[model samples]
Target: MTFEFLLAFAMLVVASFGHLGMWIALYNRINATGLKRTTIKRIEKAIVLACGIIPLLLLLIELNQHGLVGVLAGLFGGASAWSWLTIAYSVLAGLLGIVLAPFWIMDRPHFAIARDRYQVTSAEDLNPLKETVKNRRLYLRGRSFRKMSKLPGNQIVSLQRNCKRLKFKNLPNDIEGLRIAHLSDIHLTGQLSNAFYRLATDWIAEQRPDMIILSGDILDNEQSLHQIQPVFDGLNAPLGMYFVLGNHDRRLTDPTMVCRKLCELGWVDLGKEQAMRQHQQTTLRLIGNEQPWFQRNPSPYKFEPGRTSPGNEWTIGVSHSPDQFAWGIENRCQLMLCGHTHGGQIRLPIVGPIVAPSWYGTRYASGVFEKNETLMHVSRGLSGVHPFRWGCLPEVSVLELALL
Candidate 1:
C-alpha cells in the first residue's frame, strides 16, 4: 500500500478503537448502578448492537458514495460529520490512553509486588487444597466449572492466596504480625460449586487470621444463600469477621437477608453503620460505604485523622469499590479493603485490565494502591457474575500489618 493509504488505514483503526472504548465506558457506568440484571443485559445488548451497526453503516455510506480512492480521500478530507482533524486528534488521544491507564505498570510504581513499606512474604496457588469431605456431589459440580473454563488463557480456577506484610508509616509496635484474611467479590450465582467455596473457607481457618474481613458482592442470587453455610462452615476469626455489601448483592431477592445470614454465621455487619472494635490493645474503626446502591443513611465516620492515632488506634475502611479511596483518605483510614472491579475480570496482555466497573476506570482494579496515609488492598475477588478470567486470577489475601 502507498504511504497515504497506509496512514489512512492506521488512523481509521485507532479512531475505531477509541469509538468502541467510548461505548464500553458508557455501558460500564450503567452496569455499576444497582439495576436489574435483565435491564442491564438489555441495555448492554443495545450498546453492543449500536457500536457494531454505527461503524458498519458509516463504512458502507463512504463506500457507496465514494470508490476506494474516493473513500480514502474523503477520510483524509474530513468526509461527512467526522472531520479529518477531529479523527486525527481522537486517534492521538486513544494512543495516549492505551499507553498508560492499564499499560502504565512499566515503572513498577503502583504495580510493584513489594512496595517500600510492604512485602509479599508468601504467595500460594491453591485450586484443590483438599477434597470436600462433607460434600462430594457439590465438589464434583463445582469442579465442572473448571472443565467449562478450559479454553485458552482462562484462569478461572487459579486461586492465589497472597500473604502481604504491610507496614504503615504509623503502625503500632504491639500489632506487628497481625494477620487479617481479606476475601471479597464472591459472586455466588450457583455457577461456581459450593465445594469450591467450602475449600476456600476451610483455607481461611488454616490461615488462623486474627481478624477476618469480607469486602462484598458475596451473593448474586438468593438461591446460593443456602450454599453460604455449607461453603463457609468453619470461618472462625478470633478478632471478629466483618463484612459489607456490594452492588451485586443488592440484586439478590433481599440484600438484608444476605447480611442477616452472614451475621448469623458470626460475621459482623459493617454495612449498616460505622463500627469501632477493640482488637488486642489497638482500636480498629471500620467504616463501610456502599454508595450509589443501598445508601440511604449518612456516613457515621468522623472523617478526621486526629480522632484516632495509629499508635493506639488504626482506622480501616471497607467498601465494595475503590472509588472510595478518596473517602478512605478523608476518613484518615490507615488501610482500606475493597473488591468490586474483579481485576477487570479479564486482563489482556500489555493492556492489563480495561473493563473494570469503577468510576476511576481500571486505576485500582486490584492490588495495593497507596495515597496520603491510607493504603488500600483491592482484591481480584474469588468469583464474579462472569464465569471465567484471563491473565487476572481470583484472589484470597492475608494482609499482615506491622510497624514501619
Candidate 2:
C-alpha cells in the first residue's frame, strides 16, 4: 500500500475516537437537560441519524471516487468538523452561564451538629448471592435493542445480591447500631421479571434492617406497577418501607397512581416530603426528594441542626440522583442515599465508568463520598433502562451505624 493510504487510514481511526467522545458528551447533556421526554426522544433520534448517515455518506463518496484526495478529505473534514463544533458549543454554553450567574442565588452551607464526630471503622465488600431465572417469552422491542447493542440478555435477567457494612464512630448512643437496607433503581419491566424483585426483597428481609429505604426507579412502566405491588407489600421493616420516585417513575401513564399504590401496600410515599420516626428514645428525620429531570427542586427542605431538639436527632436525605449531595450538605444532613447513575451500567478497571448519566460526570457515579460532616452513598442499582451490566455489579446496600 502507498504512504498516502496508510496516513488516511490512521486519520480515520483517530476521527472515530473523536466522534465517539463528542457524541457521548452530547448524549450526557441531553440526559441532564430539563427537556420534555418527547423532545429528548426526538433529539436522540436526530443524533443517531446524523452520526450514522454522515459516516456512511463519507465512506460512499470516497469509495466512488477511488482517489487518495477524496478519502483523505472526507475523513479529515468530518473529524475537523466534529472537533470544531464541540469547541464552539462548549464556549457558547460557558459564556451563557457566566451571563446568567448574577441571577443565580448561592445556597448557604449547613453544617451537621454531632455530639461527637463519626469516623469509619470498617468497610468490607460482600459477594452477591446469585440466582438465575429463565423465561422464554420475547420482549421484542427491548430484546431487539439489547441484541443490536450486544448486551447480554441472560445477565440482565440474572439476580445478584451484595451487602455493604458501614460503621461510623461517635454515632448517637440512642440511634447507634441502626441498620438500613437500601435498594434503588429496580426498573421492573418486560426485561426484568417480577420473580427477580421477589427474590431481592426476600434477601433484603433476611437482613432484618431497622429501616428499608428505596431511593427510586421502582417501576419501568405503569403496567408493572400492580404486578410488583405484592412483592413490595411483603417487605417488613419496623420503621416501614419508604420510597422516593425516580425519573422513570414519574414518566408513567399516571404518576399519581404509582404513589397511591405504594401507599396502599403499606409503604410510606416519601416523594418530596419529610417524616420523623421515633425508635426507642431516638428520633430520626427522613427527607425524600423525587427531583425528576423536568422538575428538579433545588431546595426541597431547609434542615437546620440547631432548630431541632437536642440529644438524639439524626437526619438522612433520600433522592433519586446523587446530584442532591450538594443539597444534603447545604441542609446539614448527616447522610444522603441515592441511585440514579446505575454505576454507569458498565465500569472499566482503573478508568472507571466511561459514561455516567449525571451532570457531575463520574464524580459521584457510585459507592460512597464524604464531604464536610455528611456522607453519601450511591448504589449501583438493582436494574436499569438497559438490562446488561459489565464490570459494575448490582447491589443491595446494608449500612450498619455504630458508635466509636
Candidate 3:
C-alpha cells in the first residue's frame, strides 16, 4: 500500500477502536445499572448499532473529505512514538490473553471437583434438542431475537451441578470441610420452565450443605417471584440461607417484596441485616453489600478500605456484583461471595467472557480469585436476563471451604 493509503487506513483503524472502546466502557457501566429494563435495553441496542456503523462512516468521511493527513496530525497531536507503542503492546497482550487462556485451567487454584455432575433436564426429563425446538416457539417475538442473535446458546438450559472444595487462608482449621452451597443468578423470568430450576435444587439437597448462600439476581421480572418457593423446596442450610439483592433484583416493582418472600421461607435477609454464626467454637461473620443498586446498612463489619476488623473473625461478604471485592479485602472479609456477571453469559473462544456488567469489565466474571489474605468466589450463575449461553454453562456448586 502507498504510505498515504497506509496512514489513512491506520487512522481509520485507530478511530474505530477509539469509538468502539468508548462505547464498550460506557456499556459496561450501563449494564451495571438497575434502570428500567426497557430503557436499558433500548440503550444497549443503540450502542451496539453505533459500534457497528460508526466505523464504516468514519472511513467514508476520511476518504470523502480527503482530510486523512490533517486528521492524523490532530489525532496524535505530535505525540512521541512512545505513545503508539501502546497500540502494539495492547495487541500483543490481547492475543496472549486469548491463546494462553485455555491453559488457565493449570494456573487455577487447587480445587477438587469433589462429587456429582448431574445432567439437569426438564421436569419431564425431555431431550435437550427437543427443548431447544420448544424454546423457539415459546416466546416467539423476544425468543426469536435471542435465538437468532446466536449470542449465547443452550448452555443456559444445560444446568451444571458441581461440588467443589475451595481452600482459603481465612478458613479456620476447625471450620474446614464446611460445605456451603453457593447459588446465584437464577433469573426467574418464566422463560425457562420452572422444572429446570427445581432439578438444580434437587442436586443441592443431595449435597446436604451446612450453609446455602444465594448470591443474587434471583428475579428479573417480578412475576417470576412466585416460583422462588417451589423451586427452592429442598434447600436448607443449618448455618442458614442468606441472600443479597443484585442490580436486576432492584429492577423489580418491589425489591423489598422479594426479600420479604425469601425471609418468609426462612432465608436471612443479609442485604440489610447482619448475622454472625458460631461453628466449632470459631466466629463467622456474614456481611452483605449491594452497592451501585441497593445501599448498604451500617454495621461494625462494614469499614473503609485499608481498615480491618479483628483477624479471628471470618467475614464472608455476599454481594450481587463482584465489584465490592476490593471493599471486602480492605475490611478483612476473608471470603466474598458474588454472582452478577453470569460468567459473561457468553464467553467467546480464547477471548473468554467479553461482556460482564461491572466497572472492572470481565476481569472477575466468575471463578475464585485471592488477594492479600482475602478470597472471593464469583458464581457463573444458573440463568440470565436473556436465556442464552455460548461456551459457559449455568452453575450450582457446593463449595467446601478448606484450610490452606
TM-score of each: 0.84, 0.75, 0.76
Model 3 is weakest, by summed lDDT over 10 consecutive residues, at 112-121
* Candidate 3 global TM-score: 0.76
Ranking by TM-score: 1, 3, 2
The number of the candidate with the highest TM-score is: 1
**lDDT digits (tens) for residues 234-351 of candidate 1:** 7887778899998888787779999888888988888786777786788878888787677744465674555554468878899888888888888788899999989888877776
Q: Candidate 1: misplaced stretches above 4 Å?
A: 34-39, 66-114, 127-147, 296-299, 303-310
Model 3: colliding residue pairs: 153-389
Error of 2 at 23 (Å): 1.8
Looking at candidate 2, the ten consecutive residues that score lowest on lDDT are: 104-113
* Cα lDDT, all candidates: 0.76, 0.66, 0.71
